[model samples]
Target: MERIRLTGAQATMLATLYGKAMDARSPNSVLHDTMALEAVRRIDHDFSKVGIKPGDASTVALRSLHFDGWTREFLAAHPEATVLHLGCGLDTRVFRVDPGPGVRWFDVDYPDVIDLRRKVFPEREGDYTLLATPVTPAGWLAQVPADRPVLVVAEGLTMYLREEAGRELFRAIVERFPSGQLVFDGFSKRGIKLQKVNKAVQVAGATLYWGVDGPAELESIHPALRCVSAVSAFDLDGFDRVRLAYRLLAKAARMIPVMRRMAIMYRLEF
Candidate 1:
């Protein structure tokens, strides 16, 4: 494959794919995203520049597990619901989740990223659609059907956007869908600061723009939305061996007020 020049946000797709690929190879992996592994093998880029360290791969898997778990719960409640995967990279989440025949799924991202996805993955028409558009400014939201309850998910996104832009994006989703849920992972102020020196961010040349100290504060983004739950990454399960590592570090982290607010996952309803 020829090398592709990508902006910071677009380059992030590669890092995420690397992380998922690493998790899939692990014996005790939680995400098991084989598609990601295959996609990485087929892509001709030098993945070494992405800076996906072993611990970073574990973090990605843990976050993916949270989103996957929440999605399953939502689908169970509304089997016919439409699922919108915001900033859908080459992670192959649809393949991993397999929401069954009743649901319609749309993967939205930048046009170039979507083009790459089409080339690498087998096309699944009718039930699955690949949409290419900028997530913020949200012009693409008009294309998604809003009549049915929707489950919108954004993983490893949001942090790259300014607070105002991120709020507009969330507000658009809540306004477009009469009833739905929005799930996403966000960094705290401290996380944003730490990201500046994070190897992956350094390699990708990306900036972390938005971070929330408390996940519940995301509710302020839109009047129609309310936070269902906000939990720390350390509180969630599926960490496997890392759970112990997190616990041991928990006390040390708490000593630093900023580190305590590093990462969190949120479930919200509108």
Candidate 2:
């Protein structure tokens, strides 16, 4: 099969898929995304350029674990809630979670990406909907059900967006829903700098434009939003010299706010 060529931002989704696939193959993996593993095998692109070393793949697996756990909890609490997965690339989350009959799940991304997803992924079951549109402060949200609680997940996305764009997106989401939860990851300025040279990012031609130190600053982006919790990549369970470094950095970041910017898993409520 001919390989699909994607824009840098679009290709970042491939990076996460690679991570999930690699993790699934690991013996004691945090995320067992068999779907992701399959997707990686089906796609005919050179994944090595994503510069995902063993440590980096482990980090990606941990991040996937965090998002998966968070979403499961949310669905358990609000079985009938609407789930809006923004910038959802080729991720097989819907199949993995299987939110059942009551939940309304939406997977959204660029029109081209969604088209590719439809071809590669299995047909949707139940109340699953796919929206192909740019995720911004515009037409897309109007189509979503506003009355029910919303669980929004934006993975491997914000770093490519400008600060104002990120602010506008969250603000729009908060404004549309009566109440809900938003889970995403944010990197610090230093991390953005590192991404420029990252093999995968460079190969994908994606650029990192934004970073934040903590959830408090993001809370300022929208009045209704409040920080619930924030965890560092190092705070997750793992044993490695790099993981130890992250653990130590996470602890130190608590003392020094700037250090907190390294990488964060944030849960916010409105």
Candidate 3:
């Protein structure tokens, strides 16, 4: 088994990984991600330290499904597009989506995280690549051919970056790709200040720096950028499938505007 020594925000990935695995094991699994289940069995880390509660599994699964749906939507229309999964940390999205042969997929993250990924996940086929880097204004983005329509997905990443850096990262991608979509989930400013609410972030003792209050915050960045969708947690397609406890929590959150803004998923076209 592969042992891990990641800490801080990087260590938080393990919590999310564990949650997805638990979700996949459930009878009414949201993602039905057997890949995540396999990954947990292969890792030798102490998941208890990550502080993933039973209820957290469905939240992780639903978030992944939301992104996966958008990815499938894009690929169904443009089967030959390029996909850049930024801050990819042990996520089996490529395995789950299983894009067509004409597609080019890149799973990118920090060098150490990429190294851990190789240890746990087996080799894959297709025009797939894993680029390991710090993912700032990510110089590695330059390596990806800008010729095709791009689909950029960043999960649980932007909060770790300073607000300016997050915008800059998006700026780089929009400037490089002629036309494409940027899909990601982000916290409201209130959410960033209340990081203790996120079990993984609390357990990892990680600091979160940025908050995306709404789609207009990013759409203002570039002339070509347009907000395609800005969905709150309650608005996700599979809300009814989420466990009862979280469904109740979402109900209560909806009563308050600040709580409602705590979690949001955004998709933009440029």
- Please give each candidate's TM-score: 0.92, 0.89, 0.97
Model 1 C-alpha RMSD to native? 2.0
Each prediction's number of clashing residue pairs: 0, 3, 0
Q: Which candidate gets the maximum lDDT versus the true structure?
A: 3
> Which residues of candidate 2, in runs, are more than 4 Å off?
239-260
Q: Which residue pairs show collisions in model 2?
A: 49-199, 49-200, 50-200
What is the C-alpha lDDT profile of model 3 across 1-270, one tens digit per residue? 888888888988998899899998899899998888899899898787788866678888999998999999999988889999988999999999999998999999989999999988989988999999878966888889998999999988888998888888888999998899999888988889888777688888788999888888989878889998888876677778777987888888888888888889889999
Evaluated against the true structure, the overall lDDT of model 2 is 0.81
Best-fitting candidate, scored by TM-score: 3
Q: Model 3 segments beyond 4 Å from truth?
A: none
What is the TM-score (0 to 1) of candidate 2?
0.89
Better of 1 and 3 by TM-score: 3
Candidate 2's displacement at residue 204, Å, is 1.4
Q: Per-prediction RMSD in angstroms? A: 2.0, 2.6, 1.1
For model 3, the local distance difference test gives 0.88
- The residue ranges of model 1 lying beyond 4 angstroms of the native Cα positions read 243-247, 254-257
